[model samples]
Target: MDGQENEEHANRGEDVPATDRAPRPAPRRDGAGRTGRRALRRTGVILAVLAVALVGVVLGVLAGGRVSTDIGPFQADLSVAPAFGGGTKVDIPPLGALLLDSHDGPTHLTVELGALDQSRTEALLDDPASINRASQSAVDDVREGVLRLGLRTLASAVLVTLLLALLVFRDTRRAAWAGALALVVTAGSLGTAAATIRPEAIEEPRYEGLLVNAPAIVGDARRIANDYTRYAEQLQRIVGNVSQLYTTVSSLPVYEPAPGTTRVLHVSDMHLNPTGWQLIRTVVEQFGIDVVIDTGDITDWGSEPEASYVGSIGLLKKPYVYIRGNHDSGRTAAAVARQPNAIVLSNTTTTVAGLTIAGIGDPRFTPDKNTSPAGSGLTQQTADQLIGVGDQLATTVRSSPRPVNIALVHDPASAGPLSGTCPLVLAGHTHDRQVSKLPEVPGKGPTQLMVQGSTGGAGLRGLEGEKPTPLTMTVLYFDKDKLLQAYDDITVGGTGQAQVNLERHVVEDPQAGVPAPVTPTPTR
Candidate 1:
């Protein structure tokens, strides 16, 4: 009984000890909860600041007075400042620089920028890929830089607005509200002011100040830009007409001298007419021409700028033989040499398509200088100088092992001195088509002197007059033996009009046995 009692006592003792354990302290308020609340407040403050900054940036960009970028080849200056109400203004100086300075007097022209749609403007601002694919990255960089500048300006405005609000309101919450309200009001005012200004359907950006002294063509700049597409289409049509004309000439009986005769297309006095290229290309392809002979006056002034005009001749795939005229400057020869197919002849003979061709350039650099004898034709002084040049070339042609088959010159006076040296003598300064059998020289076959008319209808000079001169070109046929067989003369109406008339003349009938080859002799 005592042992059992002792066991119960031990159990009771342990239970008593457990009851003495201290009550768990009331659950301590979690410190993390306070920390979480504090963290949330900080996050809200940061977000609010970021939102305000974002708003300020956006507002600043919209209200920015002007944004400009110096894009390559052009300066894109956009003015958002209140102007003529609230319309945006874009000014580009380089846009007006494309005009050619081919006119006289002070030229004034205006172009409407609104002629382009919004999409075009956006494309131009963003990438300018349509105008030049290589400038896309540069354009994008410029746009971004302008936006960044606006952002910086907005940041400064926001800072100032916040300071002002704090000073006036004297309370943080009130200051924030005041600042936001002021920004809203300012943006609203700008928007309203902008709305008052309406954009013109066609707004010609003011370019007079920029172009007043620019050395460029003095024409209506606006018209050139607007009519650019029309000009391009006209060029295409000209090329097509050339192809058709060739087909027509091929079908003509007189154009074909024999089964395998060498056909030569003579073109001269182009005077910078862009149409001449297409015309030459078409004739070469259609007639299967063996060679092209240009007697000179390819350009009027033969200035450096006119060098680009000579590039058109490169389009012809056939061998092109050329000689400079009085109007063609020395620079013209340099440009002609750059052409892949051009062969510049200077008192030299070259064999082309089995025909010996010799040529001499004109002596005078400018044709206007010799106007003293314009009424009665070339003066004896000018004629003697031309004859001297012909004599010099005649010596070269007469000395060549291969008899010179054709002689090319620019002035008619030069043609007379080489009458018996070649069977066919070509000249073009007269700008009048003349084909005459030269008086037979004692011991030499009669030579046919052919003068080609102005291929460009006197070019831009013709526009100065009441009527433009007619465009003319000639096609000369040669037999297998390289003797002049027959020829066809083609004439077309003046600029802006297309009226082609062709006349065929038989120089030497093929059926009427080939005349003895002209014995080459030196001109006295």
Candidate 2:
């Protein structure tokens, strides 16, 4: 194409006017523009491709290597349980059933899956039957495999970059810059994750707390890395799909405006969203909130998923009551409890403005060796790791002498028969999975109920009763009578409010602030 004609084509990536429709001047095969432009086209592709490839290498090298199984039939089917020779079991769930078996004699199998515990793992290795040495090999394999994957990822980038450089940009720098940016992001992300993954995780996260729960988290980083490498849908599934959720709206109004309390905003399962966190902040400021109670799951996977924990922490700083959600990770629970302003009461009772607050129950009924029943009291209580939480909760409630009681917990199931005796109960584990004023079982008194909704809650995808439980948050405004009173309902991702009766509550002050209210309400 001539220079003038080429200029038009370059500016408009399509035919101009197209009166004749004459094959569009042969589509600029060679340099159609100026001599400099032509020269750029000739050199840019080579440079961009090289730059892209180089970037990929850096990314791969920076991230840990992934171990790839090359030889052997380490294949196990979904039907098989992930087990060791001695029946040590692991659960790799949400994915499906797995094939876990013992091979040959001792059934010693060395897998580069970066999670096996070497110490206890070594104990097993010593067995005459165990061939798997369970050492640095797995780490090395994962690290190497990650690098290889990075290389492959970079290779793809180079090819795409080459074409775009030669045809689209006519300058190598743009494509090279994009490629380099990808590499930089990958490297930086990997570097940060590596630092955060820690020796604890690297050494033996899988077999650490409870061997059963380890397998799923063992390959988490690697799998997340792989999915995110090519910007795959799988990556989106983890990060993107986690937010933007909905739950059923409750018919019960939280409160009827009363004298003393300014505004009572009930919220639960705010699940790691800064914007959602900001909502409570705005509401607290707007409504003049007296006490904010959190049901639970403030952190996803507790501490294991540090990013979510850190991100959510910023969103949740306020004079409020908090409960645990099933998704809460260890780090977040720890952080919240440690906060000077954070009042974390497990089964213990706290009296706030003459109101009794008590809490109990966690999302997980079966205690993993890592956490206690009601969770580490307030956050810093390490005693939970040993004595267990459920039993501890019962003991804790007995400690409190508060007249009015407010109960808090991670799950609604814990609201068993004895729950209503407390007067007011608050929970979040169910995520409002099922809606409809729950008919009180025969003996229990009338207790207001609400489960905070989360983007991670089960409701949005479908009915809570179908499979995953729905999510929602419950709010209550206690009146001066020490009676379980006004209630309001807040739905996740919804806007609008219902006015409720407000009450004036008085209290006996403790050194920390207020003594435990008559009712025990554990902060999840």
Candidate 3:
């Protein structure tokens, strides 16, 4: 301290106060810098301790990763066929190094397990598997709890210390005890609140999905396994009838009739859910439609995790045409390709009874690597399904002698190169979650690109926060001019989270190849 002032005095030609004459800092009694400094020191020590604790938690999670899991019988390996998605399909290796199907062999649950990143899966399986806020939510909750507790403890301690300082050490102990009581009370109240707000975790809770939660996300998958387990002993078990609840929603579609077209069928982002597939059978039969086009996401969800739901799904009738969706695993399209009835259009053309169709599957605004299991929350394996469709389109143009030119794709952005060439463009990645038309493209014929909404919401949504996305599909009819005639907004809600109820545009002209009178779009 003396040296600091001496250096300043030498540089500025100032005199230094002598030790005896120097003024003291006045004990800083009211200023309380000492107390403040001590409090800060305490806080810093607490924070450092907390940081180490967090690091320990992260390390523990990494080391224990889903430690032990039992997915039961459905946990069998699914022999995924490349022919399902076609176009020289490539198999997705499990975790690069680990083979999910090798030890005790591949089980259905293993497929699902293989799809998830290890850490996330482990956190989800945490003992009681916290259901309050979910895995990520629980992590955040505990962190906040610990921090608030620590802060409150410090505050109470400091305040008590300040009051106690005016007295003797004998009374200081009492002040400390009061501070401890405050911490206990605060912790108790906070703990109670956390418990009250926490939701129930589905730890294999016979899960008949009564609400929107992680369990519901895999409702179909769960149901599929249950059917096999008891030979469907609970198949007839009637809980609250969600079937009747579906009637409350509206349904609609967008289709182009030559001049004035109507009664066309459209489905998008099927993601090849069995429920949507089943609906397709009824839709074609009921509407007595000439065309059915799937915008994309027919199959391919990282792994065969969702494939377990395909038991009843494969029974659905094939669509006239399908475009690749980012989520599609390519299994649906690959299966469809085996039959002449189903067609996939990537960047090329297809004609359904001379109606020109063009589609591009999940087109390139990004690399396929980034598409699934990341930005799209899907795996690269599923994203590859869209690519297979793209390759198919490329092959269709080269192999076929006739120009069956109609493009199919999972994304609107990739349709960039083929815009002006094709008369009709169809897509489905957006899922019609919004209440507006988003088809704005220079290449999508004279009109905007068509975004076909999903016909199946199923178990695929978050609870509370996720809005009511009804099941709906659109159909476009092209007369000679290929102008859109009537847009039917077919909404189907209440069909559980998975039912799809659709209605077609009332077509005035039913023709093999004639143009319908052009009518303006209806005002909703």
* Alpha-carbon TM-score of each model against the true structure: 0.55, 0.39, 0.42
Q: Per-prediction count of colliding residue pairs?
A: 4, 82, 67
* Of 1 and 3, the candidate ranking higher by lDDT: 1
RMSD of each: 18.4, 25.1, 21.6
* Model 3 alpha-carbon miss at residue 457, Å: 1.7
Model 2, residue 77: displacement in angstroms? 43
Candidate 3, which segments miss by more than 4 Å at Cα? 1-242, 245-263, 300-302, 305-319, 330-332, 363-406, 433-445, 462-466, 480-483, 494-524
Best by lDDT: 1
lDDT by residue for model 2 over 94-207, one digit each (tens)?
A: 112222232212111233222334454344323412323322344454455445554554454445444544465566676666566655544444344334433333223234
lDDT of 3 at 17: 55
lDDT of 1 by residue, 1-524 (tens): 34565567678874424444446778777898899999999787656654554455344444553445544334454433212223332333222222222112211112122122445434443432344442455457555644554444444445655765456446688557646654564455444543343333232333333233222333554675577666545544544444444344444333556777888999998887766665677667766787999999998766665677788777887888999988788889989989999999988989999889999898988734344322256677787888898898888878989998889988877776786777778888777787767676888776877889988776655555666677788888888888777777777666545456667666545433233333222111
Query: Which is the leading candidate under TM-score?
Result: 1
Models sorted by TM-score, best on top:
1, 3, 2
Q: Kindly provide the TM-score of model 1 when superposed on the true structure, using C-alpha atoms.
A: 0.55
Q: Where is model 1 more than 4 Å wrong at Cα? A: 1-254, 367-377, 509-524
